[model samples]
Target: MSLEAPVVRGVELADDRTPRPVTASETVYEGLIWDVRRDTVDLGSGTVRRDFVEHTGAVAIVAVRDTPGVEGASQVALIRQYRHPIGATEWEIPAGLLDKEGEPPLAAAQRELAEEVDLTARTWNVLADFHPSPGAMSEAIRVYLARDLAEVAEADRHTREAEEAEMTAAWVDLDEAFAAVLAGRIGNATAVIGILAARGAKEAGWVTLRDPDAPWPAHPAHR
Candidate 1:
């Protein structure tokens, strides 16, 4: 199906489920990373106050390459980095926040690819986009498929520090990565979703893959 159909269909479906207007809202806390806000929603029959996190969305990349060893095998770039919230150095695809004002999602992906792994890709496509958690946060992540990779010069590499200082990058077989996701060894939301999505897309011959700069309505800043 054409990509526009999904967009239009979503809007049409939304017309029937539109929620009551927000009569009032206030920021309870403002921080460097995210903000907490209370929204007074009118539910027609009643009204309620709910607190949620206001966040800037993020992006991830599934950087893949063809390896000569196996007939149907492929390799993907993954990073092992410490996540403070989880208190673990989980394996994940290269990803970063979309915090820059007016920056296109594709550009943020490109910048993240170069900054995280010091690599660049000649080809890029939208692999998958999803909300990690919708109940309490307004964040989402768009994953991209990046191929034809090349390493950047040492002098131009992004310097690492803090949590990223101990990070390690590796090239793992795509099948192994997906297996890890199924086995629950890799718990990072983006990595698990992106790996499985990439496998499915590859099986389907990537026919449904969208352009790197595809429209993402879930990302409020992008719209």
Candidate 2:
């Protein structure tokens, strides 16, 4: 393998220097999403090794809802839930990881929307697709913007995992979501990037980014 580092955003990294490689390692992690493999890389010189990182592909759905307000009919959606990693509950847009094999990104988004909120979208716009952390994980988060909204016929949602606990969905204001993003309340990367991009498209009055090979770049059907 080439000893080159992937350039992202602005930084260009140097190649790693590992003296010796290990011959064996073990699975060091088991999580709700991904399993971690601790590998022994042969470093060519002596006996020193670093753990190699791997991950299952993950997707983050950026769900937005349409609201009819006097101030230009801005669209937004509710986002919250306990993130065990961060340990504090924050209100934002609905999003989750499709941390399973053979799962489609759009399908995961649709499911997450139905479960988190009781709504569905007739139109969908692909906002962005990128890795949240590329250094150690290979998660490609595909973010989409749902539009031309309609509610699902039967809202299948749950507050309890197996009916042991009660949970609820909260209403998220569109303006507030945007403002929260600006104020740094909305820390979810997909939500922030997708909403800001959508807003930028509206302000620019044109398509800012789209599928390069798509015939109808601005059309939602291209998503």
The estimated TM-scores of all candidates read: 0.89, 0.66
Q: Which candidate has the highest TM-score of all?
A: 1
lDDT per residue, candidate 2, 13-110, as tens digits?
A: 44333234458778788767576776666655545444434554444444555455556546676555666688866554656666545555667677
The parts of candidate 1 lying over 4 Å away from their true place are 1-20
The total number of steric clashes, by the backbone 3 Å criterion, in model 2 comes to 5
lDDT agreement with native, every candidate: 0.89, 0.59
Q: Once model 2 is optimally superposed onto the true structure by TM-score, how far is the C-alpha of residue 173 displaced, in angstroms?
A: 4.4
The residue ranges of model 2 lying beyond 4 angstroms of the native Cα positions read 1-26, 39-53, 155-173, 209-223
Residue 204 CA error for candidate 1 (Å)? Answer: 0.7
